[model samples]
Target: MGQKIIRFSDLTGTHVENDDDLVRIVVRQHPDLEDGPVEIEALGGELTAVEELALDLVTIELHRPGADEPETVVLEAEAFDRLASATPMAEVLRGAKKVACPIPSQTAVPAGAKERVNYASLEHAGRPHKGRTTDAEKQLVRQHLDRINERLAAEGVRTIDLGNAEHVVRYGLEALARERGVTLG
Candidate 1:
């Protein structure tokens, strides 16, 4: 379970419930956020249901006061949302200052936006190759078999063994087998 980071700028009207321990004063000195130390005080400790979330700039840890717990509990995305309370999306956006715009790059995605193929990594990775396999696809796999095996191992998928007839047939790798002087079943 990966813990998602919550930045102060990404939230709106952050009033958490049962939040006697949420940090009241945060001095953010980041260049993009403000010019100097901005003392955000007197939030009155309430669990503001998270209206927005972003990562890797700054993080605010929400903890229940005096719970005899660890310093921080790393929670998954859904778990964080369930525990957090914030202003509604509309309320958060109402005349909010300083929306964090992503850098001008092909890989930059805005906050609250979904990235393609993340579902694959989060939901479908490590499973066997599924669906139909075209001849072109098989040839590509054959061309990059070594690199593919590396990626597969990184993703916790089993590497293809040339000696296994089932792997050759499943991946339509008979051409690769022939190149390796392997006799296919």
Candidate 2:
């Protein structure tokens, strides 16, 4: 893929040569736009060559935001050469202040809050079945309590002591929810 950095007075993007003698331009939008980026490609055009140098004047198809169809735009040879040059497109765009659409104020909680709320709600709603506990299950519960106590001790926090295996496991889960800032009501 052959690429050229194009920076105009108003717009900035990259022009790339694709297979079948077609060229493509990809322009990044301002962060505030939120509409997405733009893409332009050459529909049909053979590059004219004089001696060994290729001429510009390439006819390109433009795809803008909310456009009904792709439009044709003619790029001068000099403009094409500038785009094909080694200049960085980002640097060129950064030189000018980008005009962007106004960002709407956020009213809802941050995106991840809903997921945390759901998780905490589910944790509080579900309880393990109180089936007959085997010696192995009891031992596993003791191990979990020991690990929780170790963590609490390391954090200089108060450790919990539950007489039964079920109580210990329940307390450990509640502790985990609290650690994640999830209030289990």
Candidate 3:
């Protein structure tokens, strides 16, 4: 028995806007691979820490004909470090996690009240606010922490009490809005 030596394409400069778009682009480009295999086999994780940077690490395996072997290439979610100064909007929204706000037990939507949409399954348009992963819900938190730390570095505000999940979400959302030049509220 041998471990499957998977061949990966060189995605060195591929710029995927977000996780979902990343998946779509990779699939469309590869044509042979479906979405599930790409996430499970190639990437090695459902979600990665790169999400902290408002980015996703996508592995595209190029199976070029008559080549010695396939090569693995890395694609940043939004920006191409060599050319672009900032990340693309799609990258910022891709695989963005929704900060689950707690709903009161009494106010919780009744079971099967309505068929909810899994925005995660939806495709994003060129415009913002169209995706179900709205700025209010999905905001990159870790990246925001880094930004806040930098701005307050001299002020000695490093000691942040991430007391609760919601607080973290609140902070992350605020930071993302500021960085993207948008308002979550």
Candidate 4:
């Protein structure tokens, strides 16, 4: 006898008249509730509405059955618009932001954005011992540059191998760090 249900469209001070499953509730304007479902839960002698909404993300909140509250569920504008339009629920809610972009669009990761620099050749050659540089060491440096070029390919950027490509690696690292919005050690 404590259960209650309400449609998003019937949010206003409307009455269903004879539906026992339905609860009469005052509708509040919410950014998240602009175009979403409205569910009511009976607690003791009182009722509460659970609103599930999406903005950029999915969010849920509880509200007094009919009283307006300040808190709101905000979805990513893109997601909200898409959900509102695609679902029949959209016709139930009052307003919504324009469908600017599709929802669930994957965020693109720039090339070279990897936190670790994989210099397989240098790693295989092992760290230099003392100050004696051998031919193998020079080869290792070339290999490191090759790996860097491979990483740069995904970033859709150009790689410049200066007279000493090894030294230019610092510049490459800096550019990558800046593009990735991170600092390199």
Best-performing candidate as measured by TM-score: 1
lDDT value, residue 99 of candidate 3: 53
Clash numbers, per candidate = 12, 0, 14, 7
lDDT of each: 0.52, 0.45, 0.40, 0.42
RMSD of each: 23.3, 24.7, 23.8, 23.0
Among all windows of 10 consecutive residues in model 3, the one with the lowest summed lDDT is 122-131
Who is ahead in TM-score, 2 or 3? Answer: 3
Question: Highest lDDT, which number?
Answer: 1
TM-score per model over all chains: 0.30, 0.17, 0.19, 0.15
| lDDT, candidate 4, 126-176, per-residue tens | 231323233333434443545645555555545434433343353333343
Measured with C-alpha atoms, the lDDT of residue 82 in candidate 3 is 38
Q: What is the per-residue lDDT of model 1 for residues 1-185, given as tens digits with 9 covering 90 to 100? A: 99955434213455444434445556544534323346553333332533354432323334455422223334454544444357553455474687466667856777899653321232332235534333334445665677767877887778777888877886667767888898855
Q: What global local distance difference test value does model 1 have?
A: 0.52
Ranking by TM-score: 1, 3, 2, 4
Model 4 compared with the native: what TM-score? 0.15
**Model 4 spans > 4 angstroms off:** 1-142, 164-185
- Answer with 3 or 4, whichever has the higher lDDT: 4
lDDT of 1 at 91: 55
